[model samples]
Target: MLTRKQHELVCFINDRLAQTGVSPSFEEMKEALDLKSKSGVHRLISALEERQFIRRLPNRARALEVLRMPERPEKKAPSKVVSPQLRQLPAPANDVIEIPLHGRIAAGVPIEAFEGVSTLAVPAALLGQGDHYALEVAGDSMVEAGILDGDYALVKRQEVARDGEIVVALIDDAEATLKYFRREGAMVRLDPANRAYDPQRYLPAQVRIQGKLSGILRRYH
Candidate 1:
């Protein structure tokens, strides 16, 4: 998947090529993307090339060919953020609720997150008003965020996610992963908490926001 900058650059290049039958110059691309220097544009070009989204014509200074166009996601207005202070807290609960456990989910890379179905009993306080589920974290990519392997991730069901929110993202309706949801420009970026893992990018349509992280459960023993 391409980041927002990458997506914008690719689209810009595609439009320019289609209009003039020639690739845009570095200066034009830089201006189009609002980058201070052409270096940023170069990096975006390299990234696009690596992802096979765009390619440079051999021996051509500014010739870039679009390999494929990214699919646009459905249009929807982002939900308004409710201030934490404004939200009324639920009354204290002494009971526990059983939530569906969808097996293991990768924190380091995309994996088949929904597999065997089971149930996990969680404190009612751990979840709020929405439909909730649980997934066992299976990797260390989110260690920096205090999510470690073997921890239980409490998720609230939702189709849309705001930028910078941690969400369970299903990729291509096959694989799912736990990462921070962010909008780079025109693409979606999934950021891992650990410095060792690189952020993942994809077309907006390729990512389905399955849920938002509600709470984390850990066993000391």
Candidate 2:
């Protein structure tokens, strides 16, 4: 059973979708339900989703579909029939946005490049704009930056990055390492976050910027 707010939210979303092809925004839902803040709406939506009454469409923030209606035990009147146009089936519940998972990349010394056919499903809200890929961090060289071992680094596909920006640096097109990209006169420098690790320097032609670090994701037990 859904809470009162959850029921109201689902009904509101369903009605909005039926009226228009789009779902209502959080602000609209909050206003409709007399919510104090958007966070409260988020919580109610989460509860409805967990109960399998609704699901979010892939790579969309406001794309919500009502899976099933809540039981209305208090209603004694006949149920209202929904028109065929407004009652279209929703996308599959397992729908998700997946980006390339390029296996593990080094956070310390450079490691040989690897290719894989793996992929990872990520929340669309975590990413924006251009293409992105995921890499499993293999070392603790960026500990001070809160990037730890076993963390998944979300990188935006880019051939260049500004100074002080953390990036995936490909060394001589043979190996890659995650570090801060810097230009020192005619040369390139890969700076590690930990003081224990020395900065790596190489000729500009020898180092290639593969991608820029967009965000980091970690799992806790």
Candidate 3:
């Protein structure tokens, strides 16, 4: 069986090659997987090669070849009747904005450099004019704010956010999390909507504002 890190690296390389027709560089892989150094990436590559999951070209740089791609789960057929709630979502008439759906954000640990696994389209009016991206919610911390697990949080890319607004906050440059932003004195507090979870506090310099939450989309099956 492949280790968790091995699986992540393989998927990252496969996804990058699929998107760009070129394999990702060691630096790109390192940044995507949040590894400390290129040596860590080399170790994962060696492990993947031993498993016959990937093959490294002997003479070329960044010429690693993917031998076996992982199988994706088959998508379910579309339903005949679309729900009214979904119909109400703003979609541009002539120009539908495509939002890249980055992978899930850790509500607890804070994931950084979200890999663009898919895309979601929303109306131009709803997201306004900005670089927008989507992330899958993973925890119940924001339940009171109506953001539940499995919901997509639409984020407008911005480096700063106002107090009391929902924003994607990167904590300590290691983990990215969704929370309410509030600056208290010299520290920043990330508050959860649910009462069960306590607000996380940190130094002002430790937190980096990624984007403000613009809207949310949910599906009922």
Candidate 4:
């Protein structure tokens, strides 16, 4: 059985990995747990490693790996049962939803959509009902909108994107651009936020809507 401290550590690691796609370093772990010394944190980690609940990589920073979580045994009731004032609450809703991370898509042309490139487990509370995918951003066209090259964007797949909304658009059935999507009768326009690049316009028939922008995700080193 894990002690209170060990349980806390496990929960912390799980939350961090879900959000940032990486685990924290020993020093980070120490700080997060508010331990007085790094040695104290190391002791707990060592115990966990020995139990085969987690794995440690030598000579690598932030190298802790989770092998498997220890299971909790069922609690036995006492002969004299007394219900406490505090009742157990239901589990949070987000725990049940699965978010898929679709690989990179070209903003220029009609490309085949690939599923299950990777996945992020998100709380259902944070996402709406729709097909979720990820796009690896490229270029500085939308830099003004705070999206940078190499950033990963979480997109909600949709057949129709709204005007003035940032969208991943395929123009002329060939090239793709991330821009503000707008339509005027028979024409569609892909307007970049940066002035250095000119806006692209296409006949409604020539453009294809691949996906709509839902959210942006960036990782820091």
lDDT of 2: 0.75
Compared with the true structure, all predictions reach lDDT values of 0.79, 0.75, 0.73, 0.61
Please, what are the lDDT tens digits per residue for candidate 1 over residues 1-221?
A: 44446667888988998999999999999999899999878777865775578999999778789999875422331122111111232443678899999999999999996899999987786587989999999999875455779988888999999886789999999999999889999999999866668999999999999998876777766
Question: Which structure among the candidates has the greatest TM-score?
Answer: 1
Instruction: Write down the RMSD of candidate 3 (Cα, Å).
Output: 17.0
Clashing pairs for predicted structure model 3, backbone only: 110-175, 110-176, 111-176
Sequence-dependent TM-score of model 3: 0.56
> Comparing 2 and 3 by lDDT, which wins?
2
Candidate 2 residue spans exceeding 4 A from truth: 1-95
- In model 2, the Cα lDDT at residue 146 comes to 53
TM-score for each of the candidates: 0.59, 0.57, 0.56, 0.49
Q: List, residue by residue over 1-221, the lDDT tens digit for candidate 2.
A: 34345666888899999999899999999999998999878767765675578999999878999999965423221122111111222222333569988978888898976567489876554556799998888997876555778888888899989986889998999999998788999889998766668999999989888898876666667
Which whole-number lDDT from 0 to 100 does residue 174 have in model 3? Answer: 73
Which model, 3 or 4, shows the larger TM-score? 3
Clashes of each: 2, 0, 3, 9
Candidate 2, residue 117: Cα displacement in angstroms equals 2.9
**Model 2 per-residue lDDT at 30:** 93
lDDT of 2 at 113: 62
- Candidate number that wins on TM-score, 1 or 4: 1
